[model samples]
Target: MIGVYISILILLAIIVYLYFTKRLSYLLKSKRKLLFKSLNKVEKWFLAGSLIATFTFSTLTNLVSSVIYELVSPNSNKEFLKIDEKQDTSIELISESNEKLDKLLKDASIDPRDIEQYLKNLPLKDGKEETNARIDEWYQARKISLEIKELLLVVTKVIFEQNEDLTNTITFLKSTGKTDFAGVLENIQKYFQEGDAEKIKQEYFSRKEKVEKENILILKQSIKSTEALFAFQQTVDLYKELILVEPTAENYFQTAYFLHKLKYFDEAANLYQKTLKIYRDLAQENPRAYLPNVAETLNNLADLHSDKNEFPQAQEKYEEALKIRRDLAEENPIAYLPDVATTLNNLAYLQNVKNEFSQAQEKCEEALEIRKKLAKENPKTYQSDVAMTLNNLAILHSEKNEFPQAQEKYEEALKIYRNLVQENPRTFLPDLAMTLSNLAILQNAKNEFPQAQEKYEEALKIYRNLAQENPRTYQPDVAMTLNNLAVLHWSKNEFPQAQEKYEEALKIQRDLAQENSRAYEIDYARMLIMGVKLFKKDKSNLKIAKGILERYQEVYSAQELLKLIRKLE
Candidate 1:
């Protein structure tokens, strides 16, 4: 019985220690609460009752011990317990010091008096040194933050002022159609004049991507406005700056497009080749994602080659694009078949240029068949394509001297255009005019002079109206019609009328050549040659024609001009 009592006492002592330290409760709380809640109501009640009994027993034991101690020592002169003065004071000091240190760490704005007292009372050398080092670090951090704030304010002010000036300048430019770039030019020049050239270049280059994006937006706006050519050139300049920053494929391609439009064919082709190489590498990595872009670039490159008269290169590029389009069409016919048809048409045009008539006809036929099916499904959308293909076929027939077949196709195309114009005259009038011109040429070839003249007059009227509205794009068309008229009169031996028409055509061609000599110079030289032929009978007229030809010595072959001069002498 005594042993059992001692075991119970030991267990009670362990329970008391665990309860005071919270270890037993902490272990229960750390487990999932759901496990305790899973007990039945009776089991929960039993556990509560047992905990209450244990607490009562512990309290009774503590009270009994105190009572016994009071009775047993009531008469003793000394007290049962005495506090240790030094050790108790030491513990109190440690507790106070810990509270003060915690407060200081938690509150950065503690009273200075309290902080001084606390630091002075710090008992260890290492603690004092550590606190001092932390304070120094805090001071340095604050100093750096203040300096950064000041620098930011200065930079913000400078940027705001520059932005305000730039905004006002841009508003002025827009209001004035940007015809005078003097103010903007001055603003750009000011940067160079005020700063080191290398520094200014670096600054411009650092923001070059942003500058390129903004310039591209401006270029789009300029294209819609009357100052498109000037804006295009400015955009090209921006692209050059972007290249200086980073010669990216997209930047090169953008520059190439503008260069092509500006008639800088060689430069445009070089850039396009660079873009093509980059796209090719990218396509090799992810063909499905990038092959369409490759095909588009190839198409543009082919057109560029065609414009430059690099026929073989153009043919090769067009064929490559066609093969890609064919593959894409096979994968998703509904979405990509139109691209296939378009590529076929472009290839056909190229073949026609190369005088590969049989191949050209086959490609044209295939394209027409696709377009016809597409038109049958959605006439409103694809009818124009069908008519365009018909016109192309008619031209091919005419080139082959199959007059009846050419006339049939021309009439078919004309009917389509006429119907289309009835629905939207502004859009389709140009097509009607083009078909009329073709018909007039066909009539002239067949010696139907009166009908040819009537058709030519009608086409000229349309071209004149179009040129009056947008002279930059359509003025050359007017010159072309005038040249055709001159040829018609020349064929009939109406030298005086032919000479007048040729002179008018030459004047327009001269003006066009002033803007793009490579595009218009050959036409100007041809007009001079026609003038020479028309005025051969009159010595004074012959001398005038010879002088005009000599003036374009670079455009015309010297040998050919000399032969003409010898004939005239």
Candidate 2:
């Protein structure tokens, strides 16, 4: 009894110590700035190495460190978060402008030139369109015109050639629209008069580097997290220059895979083609080394062609790829099941797209059988891919107007996307929105208006928020949604709502057309025609419509106006 009691006491002490050390390390460590800073390179390395060697230690350490660091780091001088309010504001404004412009441009009812004029007049400072846009935003937000102008001068010098005039160089930045030429020219003259070239260079490069590094870091994180194939493709492209400087098959292949995933068929196809060529040259010397790569590339190329709507081309490529896959599967059945299933699905998708429904069905079923079997064998490894194949099959059914089947597939895909979004909203939200939009469009087509409307509204809300936040990408989509909503209203005979939405869309499009007078002018003419047709009976509105049309007719073809006017008459 005494010996047993002693043994129990020792065991209890060990358990208590293990718990405290492993789980409550945060309680022991000082949650202080000095302690954090004291974590030197060697300590960090050791921590990392130890974490890798002992997952439990690393996990606990990371958890404790993260909680403590976050709690304590708030007031620390080491947490240097230097944000330029001016740049943030500028980005926001550009995003707003792009959204507005996309709406106006989509319907082709507004005069592009007039829209351009409106954009030019929307209170901007001059440089390049992007520069002016940034300046305009910054000016409105921070009132730092002199500082911005100096920065622009330096940017022009650094990004362009020695002989390039700062004014002209800044004037030609057409990313947003035409630069305000007169305003940019004045700023340039002022910059030269100030005689602060060196200061300008230093400020410009610092900001530029800061912006570039910030974007690169964001992109790196995005690449790791994003499920959207196109976004991932873009992320890969942004890093392409950096990766190209240190080229390897892994980097190249990953980028190529991302491109392929995005349905950028031409680019993806080219990448795979190059990859295959490399494999082919090496195949003679090292058949074992290169065969797998060649096979994968062939399969990728086949899928690329399939996406491009080139059925025969896709078929040929898939068959060639399949021969290799089949041979591998025969030699190593267990190892090759996944690849074989993937090839089967790709071939099926191609056939489905080509309207070879029966063959496609068979291929999908085959792939499904393989995937299902694999998923059952190893749920964690194969479940996601199985679900993907299920969705593909659902897509095939959907194309055939097999609504029940398609809905089932969509439900599965939605579940997956929803879970993904929950885990990483920033990376997966866009995809969720896209899927919602697609499903909504289908529902609308099927006359499920309420469900469709709900889906569209939800998607529009997310897209609008995204566009407002990242105007570079989502703004145009928001405009499109607005236009789509207008059309929906118009179809329902909600004339007032339709007109309001259309006008809202037109406002955005007009802002975007600032650089292209001809484009905005065309759009303005179309809007005039629509306005005249819609409001001809209202005498008060007709007068303004006719007046606007007459002024716009000077820029557009007289014949188009006369035709519209004749309709009114």
Candidate 3:
């Protein structure tokens, strides 16, 4: 193309030069008629030769350039030429389309946390117009991607149903056109026309199973990347589809596990029960093979029941798991004693919650003995367990008002936690904070005011920092510590200090209640009542406290607050 343009320009320049120099006019003069006529003929021949040479050179150069482009450029096709012509107007559109498609794929492949970050960092405008535009673009892109995926899925399904060779079909489609995914449907129609019945059925099932296996693998990847609730749900649905194809124990167990993580307790419990039944049958036939699985499922079921506060059911399942674990431990204590100890600890905690004090104490003692022995041999792993048991025992003692005994246990737990925290602050700081809080409560009960105040302050500092780091998880702990501090001040007859702490705690609880009333509203109401009692003689405080109580009158704690108000009146 460039060569042709250059040749045309050169020929024009030559003709202009001849005209400007009067050479053509001199040839056509009448002063020497014969000579002028001969010159005119010669001039005409020269002009003709120049035109032929220019035309021939331009054509030959352009042909050679076209041949080189075809040989060197990988995308040199008729479509490439068409696209090149439209590149200027369509470049941005093509780029945006590709970007949206990439985003859709990324959204499918990433976890919920990543999705949250993506959404959080998305650019925003001052008005709804830009936001609306972005949303519309996202929706359109998502819709298109989904439609394309669905089409592919349908094509795959049809090919499997017809018992055709998918590899062959894919190759054929590519041969037709590399980007011609739509051609898959046309290929499917051709396969249907060439189909045989019995052979096709056999091939269909074989190919279907292969494709199903591949899909299952992909679904597992999706599950690993799925952290958002909606993504988890979608993954669960995919698991269900896989189960429909092959209702294997692994499939059912995986689906139930995801449900449990999602906190779908009822559904998870049902699936776990089904899993247990399967494992029980398998274990009965081959105890050595599947008995361990039975025990594992029983433990999981117990934990699930415990989370739902179905303590009786939880205890029953725990005991069954404990029995199996005990038998297993007797055969190989080195391998299974840890499981035994963990189950005993779990059972002990549930017993304590149920106020079966003697039974809880016995279980805790057994767990503590096992953990102590394990820690003696392997403190790196079992020392934390020992500390945990000591803490639980301390809580039981505190509840029973055995102040000295509770104090002894709390001191032991706190010592271990302090050492652990020194080694790994991120892991053990919360434990240290909790133990300090418990010790402070025990100290207050013993009327050791100065000691209790110091402990409370220490715990309060830790809780404040933790809440600052992750308010969603630790804010409630901060509120609890503030309330404890307020009680300590009240015990010491420091009314102003007590009131200040109570107000701070109440504000936090109120903020929390806005998000989850069932969890925090009772605390808010109780704090209001404490405020009322602290300032019963002040008209302003009483009025404010009464207003807060009246506002939350529907709360369970409101009745107690109302009684305090009535006595004050």
Q: lDDT winner among the candidates? A: 3
The local lDDT score (0 to 100) that residue 20 gets in candidate 3 is 77
- List candidate 1 segments past 4 Å from native: 1-234, 241-249, 377-380, 467-539, 550-569
Q: Give the per-residue Cα lDDT of candidate 2 at 403.
A: 83
TM-score of each: 0.54, 0.42, 0.61
* Per-candidate RMSD, Å: 28.1, 20.6, 25.2
Across 1-569, the per-residue lDDT of candidate 1 in tens digits comes to 33345447756665575567555574467753653555569756765665666666766767777788878866222210111222223223323343443332222322222332332322222333454454445446663232222222332233233334435545654554553332433344344223222333333434445544333333222221211111233345555654555476765776676577567899889988998899899999999877887887898899899998899999899999889888888888778778888989998998998898889988998999999888998899999999999999989989989999889888898999999999987668778899999999999999998888888889899988867544655678789988899889989989788878878888999899778765666566556665666655345544554565566666536448647666856
Model 3: per-residue Cα lDDT at residue 506 = 81
- Candidate 3 accuracy as lDDT: 0.67
TM-score rank order: 3, 1, 2
How do the residues 56-115 of candidate 2 rate in per-residue lDDT, one tens digit apiece? 544565677777877876532221122223223322332334344433333223322233
lDDT of 3 at 189: 34
Across 394-498, the per-residue lDDT of candidate 3 in tens digits comes to 888888777888899889989999999989875687789999999998999899999999999999999888665446557888899999999899989998898
Model 2 RMSD vs true structure: 20.6
What are the Cα lDDT values of the candidates? 0.65, 0.56, 0.67
